[model samples]
Structure formats: structure tokens, C-alpha cells
Target: QGTLKYSFNAKDKSAEKTYQCEVDRPDPTDFSINCVGERTKLAIDIDRNLGKSKVYIDLNRFAGERFGFEAVRDPQTKQLD
Candidate 1:
């Protein structure tokens, strides 16, 4: 478990908020984390072998978006990027 915090401005006023968080790792190669509070939510998925990853965030009061990434290791050099 953890905490998620953020600050934002609306109409020239700044405010900060915090959320309770939880993380889960069902396997050694893959895992996920989630944080939620009020009307906001944040989630993430990761692969240990440099395969794929995803992230999503929503703050209810604003726009939300999701991102995806994929990576492969070089067989000869054993490097990932």
C-alpha cells in the first residue's frame, strides 16, 4: 500500500489531494498497481522481462488518458530499450 498525491490549478487556485493506494504482484514476471480516492483513479501494469507496460489515470474533474509501451531485448547484446 502507498499514497498518491497531486496538485492542480483551476481558475488560478491551486489545490492538493492525496489518495490511498494498493499494489499487487500475482506473478514474478508481471504486476499491477492501483490507487483510488474520491472520484480519481490511477492504474498501472508492468512486465519484468521488458515486454509491455500500460498506465491510466483519471481525475474525474479533468480529462483522462491511457498510455501503452512495448520493449524488446536485443538477443546479442542482452540490452533493452
Candidate 2:
């Protein structure tokens, strides 16, 4: 359980948002995480692709955040670029 308190807009009105997240096994073979919040939820899963070696992320449907793509992981070094 996690609690986050902040103002939603410039009105300075206080608000409290709570969330709960649980992770069972997050290893090389399998990874899963479940998160729930006031009006949003996120489910992340990482698994090997048997047919293709590709990795993708949810941008429109599942993910509602529009965080700019100014930062990315270097494909070769696996570091933040």
C-alpha cells in the first residue's frame, strides 16, 4: 500500500491518492507486477518472445502518460541514453 498526497492543479487543493502493488516473481524467466490506483491501473509483464526477439511497450491503450521520449535505453549497452 502506498499513499501519495498532492495538488491536482493550480488551485492548490489538497488530495490524497492511494495505490497497491504486488509482485510475485520478477526474474529472467518470468516477471509480473500488478498496480491499482484511484482511476488508473498498470500491469507489466516481461517474458521471452519465442517467435521474435522484440520488446514493446504500451503507449496509447494501457499507458495514459505522455512522458516525452527524451530518454531511452541504449540498445547495445543497456544503459539510459
Candidate 3:
């Protein structure tokens, strides 16, 4: 138990996702931090949250440059293809 670290749980859900970290008998001097990251969500959220922060985007490049988009389904065929 000298240098053992563990993650207690994780969640993959429809609305949100989360994680947890746990350590056994942590030392008084030991400090820890946990962070959550996402790929597509981060890419999209960056532009959205930045906009809410009173930033300007007069260049009109946030659609593909900042927040990339994907096609979940084809409108014509209604399939993943």
C-alpha cells in the first residue's frame, strides 16, 4: 500500500458521463486532482461556452473550425450508411 492508486467507478450514460478516483490511506502531504475530458463534446462545448463568455466570432469559422459536425443518419435513406 505504499504507492497504490485506484479508480472506484465510472458512468457512461445517455445525458452525461462521469468518473471517480479513490486512494487507500492517503498521506497527509499527498494531494490529488481529478478532471474530465471529452473529444467531440469538448470540441463543441469550447465554441458554445466561449460564445457565452462574450467573445466575438466575426470571421464565421466556428462551424467547422471550432465545432466540427457529424451526420448521425442520412436524411434521404434514414440509415447509418
Q: Considering every candidate listed, which one attains the maximal lDDT? A: 1
Superposed by TM-score, candidate 2 places the C-alpha of residue 27 at a distance from the truth, in angstroms, of 4.0
- What TM-score does candidate 1 reach? 0.55
TM-score of each: 0.55, 0.37, 0.18
Model 1 C-alpha lDDT per residue in residues 1-81, reported as the tens digit of each score: 988777676444347677789989988988988888777787788876666667777766676544445566554676766
The candidate that wins on TM-score is 1
Provide the RMSD of all predictions against the true structure, rounded to 1 decimal: 5.0, 7.5, 18.0
Per-candidate total of colliding backbone pairs? 0, 0, 0
**Model 2: ten consecutive residues of lowest lDDT:** 49-58
Model 2 lDDT, residue 45, Cα: 54
Candidate 3 achieves a global lDDT of: 0.29
Across residues 1-81, which tens digit of lDDT does each residue of candidate 3 receive? 122222334353454543232332244433333222232112111122112111111213334443333334454655643
Model 2 misplacement above 4 A:
1-18, 49-81
Encode model 2's per-residue lDDT on 36-81: one tens digit a residue.
6666654555443221122223344455553222334455666654
